[model samples]
Target: MTDSGALQKFLDGVVVDAAVFSLRPDYRAVLLPVDGLVPGPSDEASEALLQAAEASAREALAGRTVEDLPHVVAWREAYKSFGAKPQRTRNSLEALLRRAEAGLPRVNRLTDLYNAVSVLHQVPLGGEDLTGYVGAPRLVRATGAESFDTVAGGVPVVEHPDAGEVIWCDDAGVTCRRWNWRQGRRTHLTDDTTTALFIFDALEPMSDEALQTAADDLAAHLLRLGPDVRIVRRLIANDMTHPEGT
Candidate 1:
C-alpha cells in the first residue's frame, strides 16, 4: 500500500477511534450481498461471493458493517424491512453497490468514501450525518408496528418481527440504520461527519486473519483519500461493563 502523507494517521483513527458491534446470540451471521445484486446462494459460490464482496468493501471504505438476519416474518408471511415503514426516501441502500462499481461521485469525499466501502463489502452501513443523534443511538430490535415511528413520517409502525436485527437509535427511534437491508432516509452520512460511528456487521465474528486483512485493507484505502483521518475501534453494548470494558 502506498503511503499518502497524513493518510496514515487518518487510517489509524478510522480503525482505532470508532467502536464496533457484534450480533446477539439470537442472530446468526449470514453473508448478505448488496441487496438485489446478491445472487442466489450456493454454499461454494456463497463463500466466494462473500469473500469477494468483503475485498471490494475494504477497498472502498477500509471498513464494513457486519450483516446478519435472513428474513423478516409476521403471522405466516415474510416481508422486506428497510429500518422504517412507508419508505422514507426514494434511494435504496443497495444503490451504493451499483454506484461503487461505477466509480464514486464527488459529494463530500467522506460520503462517497463510505458508500464505496459499503458496496465493496456488500454490507449495508449507516452512521451519523454529522448532526449527533436526534434521539438515541441504540442498536435495538423491532417489536411490532407500534414500535417503529422514527422514520414513518409520523406514522407509528413496527419493524421486522422475525429474523434480522436493526440499529434502533434512540435519538430518532430508528432514524438511520440498515434494517431489513436498506438505509433510512432520515439520518444519512454527510460531508460534515467529524466524529461518527462506523458499523461492521457479519453473520459470524470474523476470524483474526480476516479482521487483520480488513484492518490493513481499510487503512490502505483511507490513505488514498487524502489525510487527517482517524479511525479507532468502539464497541457499544449495555452490560454495565460498557462496550470498551475490561
Candidate 2:
C-alpha cells in the first residue's frame, strides 16, 4: 500500500509518517454502516439535532456582524491544491442554508448536519462514509504524478504532488480525503451511510483546542441527526497539518 514508481521517486528522501484514524464499530471493526440518502432526522432525535446546530450558530453569531464574521472564503478560494476549485461563491452558513433550502438535493441527516457545521464554522468541513473507505485516514503530501478515484461529479480525481499536502483516506498509494481548503464530494455522507469520519480542522497552535471542540460538537450534532453516534478522541502521528507548529 506504500507509494512507488513515480510517487516513490518524487517523494524519495522524504518519509512522512502519516497519522491515521481507524473508525470502526465495536461489532464491525472493518467498517461502520450508515444508511445512504436516508438521514434519520425524520425522527424526533434528528430534528432536535438539526435545530440545535442551527440554534448554536445563531447564538454564536448573535452579536457579530457580517464583516466581523470569520468566514472561510479565503480558505475556500485559496485551497486549490487539488487543482479543482470548488464553486461556492456565497461562503457563509446563511448562504449555503438558503441554497439547500431552495432545494439542492438534500440527501441524509448526516449530510445536512455536516454541511451545516461547514457554514457555521466557516471552515471547510466534511464527513465520509467510512463503511467503504479503505486504508489509512492520513493526510498526504502528493508528489510526482498520481491519480485517485473520486466521485465528485466523477471526473479526474484530485491530484496531490510531492511536497503538496492533502488528506489521505488510505494505507498506501492511496488517499482518502484531501484537505485542500474545500471539502471533497466523493466520500460525502448520505442516507445510506451508517458510520462516518468527520474532519473539522483548525490548523493553528492556538486553534487546536478550538478545532477539537468543534469536531466534538459536530459529532454530537450528527448523532442527534442520525442513528447512534459515539465519538472517541483519535490521535494520528501525521496530524501535524492540523495543530500549529508541526
Q: Residue-pair clashes per candidate, as listed?
A: 43, 31
Indicate which candidate wins on lDDT. 2
Q: Model 1, residue 147: what's the lDDT?
A: 30
Q: What's model 2's lDDT at 104?
A: 26
Scored against the true structure, residue 155 in model 2 reaches a CA lDDT of: 68
Q: Scored by CA lDDT, what does every candidate get?
A: 0.37, 0.44
| TM-score of every model versus the real structure | 0.45, 0.54
Candidate 2, residues 1-246: lDDT per residue as tens digits? 111232223222222333212210100011112222334534454445456556655665566633344434333433443443445433334344344333322446676666666555544455666544444354545554544555456565665434453444353344333443334445555556665565544322215445555666665655454343444333222332434322
- Specify the poorest-scoring 10-residue window by lDDT in model 1: 30-39
TM-score of 1: 0.45
Model 2 misplaced regions, further than 4 Å: 1-105, 151-165, 172-186, 204-206, 225-228, 235-246
Model 1, range 1-246, lDDT digits (tens) per residue? 122323233323321111222323322122111101111212343333334654564464435421211111120011123233422221223444434444444444444444445445443344444234453244544443313333455764445333243434443455533433444444555444444444544322333244334444444544443354444443323233233431
